[model samples]
Target: MMIPRMLRCSVLLFLILAVTSCVHTPPLYVNLSQHNPIIDDYKALTNAGLAQRCCPEFPLKDGWLGGDGDVSVPLDATTTLFLFSDSYVGQQNQTKRNVPGTKIIANTVAIQSCKWEDESEINYFWNRMYTSNPRPVFEPKKHGNKFWVNDAFLLEGKLYVLLEEIGEKENAAPDDVFNFTQVGYTMAKIDNPYDTPLTWNIDYLPLPGFQHPQTGISCLTRHKEYVYFFINNNDRVQQLVRKAVTDFEDMDHGFEYFARDRSWQSGIETADMDTLFTGFRCTTVKYHSAVKKWVMIKDIQFKTNEIKMRCSPELTGPWSEERVVYTIPETTPGNEHYHENNFCYLPRECTQNYNSKSCEMVMTYDVNNFDLSYVINHELIYTPRVITIYLPVEESGGPEE
Candidate 1:
């Protein structure tokens, strides 16, 4: 169950980068004027504000020290549920987790009440094997496998969590993040999300044909009657698929693929669709009322200190090329705590905190290195670091993600 939590890269951006191969039409960057915006397009283009957000360190408890995969689901205007993966639970010595007997669990979760407000509180959850041994809250049923969380959304008071079951890859070095492969896509249906996750009534759903393709819970979004899923393939081709909102009970059936002709197709027709990664991309996709387009925030792969964005008029689109919006100052030399191994990752947007009037949105990412030795000394390395981005309001929405 040692999933290194590295598979959650923003594959959506990577796959979206390969759009020309699958799309049949020309650029979908519809005319800006025709799209309709709340403000003049020129004035709306304000510079983004980037800075680190608080806690500087993770609030650790006996079973929750620090972890990665901080994808959040805003349950209400003031409440949010954060999903974490490959958690460092069990123990810590001051800021370091290298204390004796410290253990790393597959996953954990946190509930933030009054989020974005001064009174907010974050509480992490896990199950106890007895008194001392803690296990992941959503433990996988498959033997020798672990559950790593993906994006989740609330529908009709229920929480639907996207998960990928992973198992160790043969002969991988202990520190290798790529030492595991996805077992398949799984759905965790929580009946009472408001209650403590420990008391949650959850059902583990093994998605039908989970092995047909290596689809990570990269992202799950909804529009009108259909909920869309972005599928990732290791070849770099991304496929958009949808199922009716009413078909939640029969999730295994009724899935329709977005075809090159803009029609929804089904069955073997999707067999030929392209993909770019073996795991889900955990990219946060949300509509910015100010910009009037869905925006995805991510840290550039290999270009660690930079944060960038890509947008599309529609999910199945001719996505705009990435634009680097911010550069992390920590990676720059001469900063108080700069390291050659300090790389940024897991960039995700906080949609509830978005202010349409100011056209500003909050975002977070984690900084880490491959060396556990370095991480042990930097207690805050795995905690979520924050930033703010602003978009230029357009005359109308011709195209954006």
Candidate 2:
């Protein structure tokens, strides 16, 4: 067999290469569970008194009051951040927005002391260098005050926020409701989200083609080794895109969409991606370990006057239809609380207020009015409607063996 040393070396090299090719790293499996979120059994979280921290009820400092777009994110165990859009901060004593003075800023932020015992403990912040003229915390680097900031999530202790860039129509008036176009999206990175928003440093990263007029960025949730982003794909459908935990700085690539084949694939082609939910909103979609279901709370505007809950076994498959968790009393025409112009949207999940053992969780919806003045005069129209959701022991569906 040792006919020639050179020939023997060549034979050994071939065998080693064959063995190496056969041995490869196994694919990663992100462990998750799923169950039905029973909406039939639920009620308002009246005890939490989350309402105490809302609107004119909370004392105003520097004319800083409350606003809509209640995009709440739990930074850590005990604190939560509220990112708002089209907020009112003007004359605290003036009941009417047109009177003493009222300025509707593009955005503002607040820090909540999530202690249900004292739900009133929350402080709002924005740049007030000119006390009478406050600027948004992350003011647009451009001229327009149309940065409708949405969906924020934390990964590796850093916060990432999605700011929608809106552009006005060439000949349209300033106050026209439908005169704006979604120009683009920018993701802001905050290395110190724990500190006051004013003290934190932000790096704005521009993202193109992510702005589809019909579908827009809404929810940003992290599950296992990946952070998943869901968009209200044309109001009635929801689409998803995700990146690895190690891929934050370069969001330009490494995106995986929930494909039509029910498999995760690279790219953003709508034909390639699958719609998971029948309806969507700019809300949180997360895994509740206690209930073992990936749950999302949302309300499709103009569809119905109810905030609903939907769930799925996996983050990207066979999602259950929504069950009405709370019928929005403020939007119901005949209800005493209802105003002719009153409406509600954007049902958000408050993770910090979640109670694990009993499968109890808190959700909030942004109340608004078609007539802008109604929000200012009514006081409660532009605030949040907080409710409590309690799930059953084991409704049905999957355990994902």
lDDT of 2 by residue, 194-258 (tens): 76677878988877648764447777777767778786776667888887867767868887888
lDDT of 1 by residue, 52-99 (tens): 111111366534678887877765444457888888776422334777
Stretches > 4 Å off in candidate 2: 1-62, 91-99, 114-120, 170-175, 396-401
Q: How close to the true structure is residue 382 of candidate 1, measured as C-alpha lDDT?
A: 72
Worst 10 residues of 2 by lDDT: 12-21
Instruction: Give TM-scores for every candidate, taking all chains together and pairing residue i with residue i.
Output: 0.77, 0.78
How far residue 221's Cα lies from its native spot in candidate 2, in Å, is 0.9
RMSD of each: 12.4, 18.9
